[model samples]
Target: MNTAAWSRIARRHPSAFLLAVQLLSLMVYPLFDGLPGGRLVFGAFGATALVLAVWVVNRSPAVNWVAWSLAIPALLCAVSAAVFRNQALLVTASLLEALLYFYAAGALILYMMNDNRVTADELFAAGATFTLLAWGFAYLFVVCQVWYPGSFSGAVEPERARTWLELLFLSFTNLAAVGLGDVLPLRSEARVLVMLEQFAGVGYVAVVVSRLIGLTILRQGRDS
Candidate 1:
């Protein structure tokens, strides 16, 4: 059904609904995948689906950006697939699905935090910690492809293994002077994701950081 139905079902059949979404989202990589243009159309729907889920389940701006941040890679894959008509996009598509699920779980964390007020330091710490962890994981994946070469499928043909990692890391990094040039996305699809993530990363920092910082400063001023 729709988001309302899914959220309600989540209350009673949470596991079932979660499993269904998660399972359906996963796709095979480096093979003959679906058409790119069609995938983009699907990506738009997926984005809407995710946003709806986030809105219906629990609307936290922080969590929304986090989920959108994750969605970037998948949307990139869909775009890449549609634009270039390549199968390599599926690899990143799978990555997006994983990110989506984790961010979706983040919603629950935000909900839990609602009960106990978390400080700015706490929020910053949590964000930074996750950012670092995500980067490390992405770094390892990219480095593996770089050093091993073909260790990951679609690393050579599309040659976007390192690039994917870079985009993924940028998605989590959230900074003004991001991108050190060590990881540059080469392919069309990877580049699309890089641009989108950079835009998103900047926007998230501007909005979330300012608000969070304002709240933190206010909290500290009040408490002090």
Candidate 2:
């Protein structure tokens, strides 16, 4: 689509397109999980979606640097996986993805918190940030598995799709503080990371709720 089309959609709904892409990715990812080059394709799609989402939400030229930084590593990951055939490439990709989405989540959360009145855009941004947090932790778990063998009990082979999927499943469960016993963090560092993610999840809900309620009350008072 052209810039004009994107601009029109963004003006109509700031984060709706981004949220739809994310939901679509979540829904379709399982179909491609086992196929060759599937991860890279989805990674590229997700990176592009995230960059566009940030652009739609922020509309600042300064954020272009961040978008480019995120996109470059994703492109490198595709090339590295397809051409070089390196297992290390997955590790690099995971790290890059984790950092990029973490930054995106932070930016979105900051934007939501700074708004004087909560709008639909802010609500969508908040949801996006929550999803980004889950994704970031999933990638972080992948990195830990790469660095320290047997960091997770159920994920023996770090490079396989099954292991990656398991880590992602565990990441979301941990974020929700579900504590399902199927996957356990064996390493001290891994456990620490899980704990931190759990804390972050709780803290995020608290902060976001407080901010929204505070803003709503302030808006009502001003109108009164």
Candidate 3:
């Protein structure tokens, strides 16, 4: 309720804050999509998510400067692209963002694996890392779409470049190994990326997530 209470929670559960913001952004995005003010709103959310991600990374074993290095330029490019509608800036921003998300995901993974005992924050990091990977792949899709037009085709507009939401949906589906929906990747490069994401999804669940589950179970057994 108060600043002190919120600060304590954040201090104890940094990953939870990042995870909550990512999920909340998903819900908030649809409202602003395709609107005149959408770019500005998306930029604000992007900046917030980046900052939260950096905070989460700082809590991990990774070098904090790397996260900040990527984040500052990514933020600047995002803002410039949104303001000027520069295609080059957009592509650069997308690429930088993808790298930053992937880096953050890696840091979180390392944090989770660093200890045998799973804490509440580690559990939260698991979910947050998954979202970070999803986001990273989605940004890659954005770059792919720009480089190879018509790479993705959806039921709504088969000829046009897919919206951010559509690309993100595709990314999630592919990463989760779920059956594809109306959106499909038509280009070879896109399909290759999708396949890579599929492998990553399977490996993450089989390795990192399963390890977390095992550790939790082991702890529970010892307590019992």
Candidate that would win on TM-score? 3
Give me candidate 3's TM-score against the actual structure: 0.98
lDDT of 1 by residue, 2-108 (tens): 99986675564433343334224333221223444444554554555455444423434354566666666666775676567665665566556545644654553
| Stronger candidate by lDDT (2 vs 3) | 3
lDDT of each: 0.47, 0.74, 0.93
Please give, for residues 12-54, the per-residue lDDT of candidate 3 as tens digits: 9999998898888899988988999898997898899899999
Alpha-carbon TM-score of each model against the true structure: 0.38, 0.81, 0.98
Which number leads on lDDT?
A: 3
Error of 1 at 156 (Å): 13
- Stretches of candidate 1 off by over 4 Å are 1-96, 99-176
- Writing each residue's lDDT as its tens digit, candidate 2 over 1-224 gives 99999888678666666677777887877888878877766766666675655565364223657756775776588467656767788788778778777777777777777747778777777777777788889889988977887778863544343366687788788877766746788889899989999998899888886688788789889889
Give the clashing residue pairs of candidate 1, or none: 36-81, 36-82, 37-82
* Clashes per model (N, Cα, C within 3 A): 3, 0, 0
**lDDT ranking of the models:** 3, 2, 1
Error of 1 at 91 (Å): 3.6
Q: List the residue pairs that clash in candidate 3.
A: none
Query: What is the TM-score (0 to 1) of candidate 2?
Result: 0.81
- Candidate with more favorable, higher lDDT: 1 or 3: 3
